[model samples]
Target: MNTRSGLFAVAVGALTALGLACGGAESVDELPPEPPENEVNFPALVQGVVNGWTINTSEEFPPIGCGAGSLINQMRCVGGNCDDVGAYCASAGATFSDTYWTSYFSEEGTNYRTCSAGWWMTGLVCRGAHCDDISIQCTQVTNRGTGSCRWADRQFSEEFPNTYSLPSGWYARGLACTGGLCDNLRVYECQLL
Candidate 1:
């Protein structure tokens, strides 16, 4: 009887050990999965509208009125001022209205121009129409013109106050375009010639 009791005690201890091992394995497997990394959280409306457009650390252009009927027009930053202006008549569906064009910097020597109508905005300089709709190649203009002759993407973000340090994998450079003109990656500083 004593031997039988001893045998029963041994069996009970083995069973308890088995139970504890199985319970530990189950607990480990039941742990929740880790959350995804590098998630971007933004509102639905902003994400939808800004999708595919260039994301830069600069103010968006306001619309402006041009032509006789005050037609709402689109303009691109060409040179000088933090927000310079140039006629942007691309059939590629670019458009701007008066809400897009506004004074960017208050520095006295900065310049801004509109290509659709020749106009320059220099501090204390008489505001007058100095450009025309003729698609003047900024490269040909010897005097520093308000409009940048560079490509759109290059000129829009690089000039003066809009300048920003590029990310690690990105390089700031220039690309030559039609008529031997080069546009800077930051469009605002794009110069003719």
Candidate 2:
């Protein structure tokens, strides 16, 4: 068949499958087959000693994303803080990761004999709205310490308290967002490990 016919066939198949799954009046045979069970216990979620966690964020505009909202979450984290945040958000329990790192930069390294610590991070990440809604929220899902992230848009140029600095002996991490409305991922919580 030509391209149009091929496309039509694919479209019909997808709709048929969707209809069958979504309360559609379809026979049992129309449903997709399930895979055979493979009983295997997955590894437990546990935290361990590491350098620290790092949460990378995106700077998308308009209908911002990343936050655990209506849209698919875009934020992911690494390190101990990642585990804690995941648990906190899921409330299932604390999970752990081993991804710690540090960064040093600039003239400060020469003048003060020290460079900027990678742990120091700041940004007003807004999703739906802008900086006007200066509300930063970090919710704990599980005792194990997993975190769910969120944020908004950017309006004012002034620096809000949208920043975080892990303690001297701590390794914290969190998600980030963009837009200029309400920061999607603001580090509202930090833990010492």
What is residue 106's positional error in candidate 2, in angstroms? 32
| Residue range 132-158, candidate 1, lDDT tens digits | 111111111223233332223423322
Best by TM-score: 2
Writing each residue's lDDT as its tens digit, candidate 2 over 118-190 gives: 1111111221212222111222222232222112222111244223433332222322323323222333223
Candidate 1 lowest-lDDT run of ten: 131-140
lDDT, candidate 1, equals: 0.22
TM-score of each: 0.16, 0.20
Q: Backbone clash tally for model 2?
A: 45
Candidate models: Cα lDDT each: 0.22, 0.23
lDDT of 1 at 107: 14
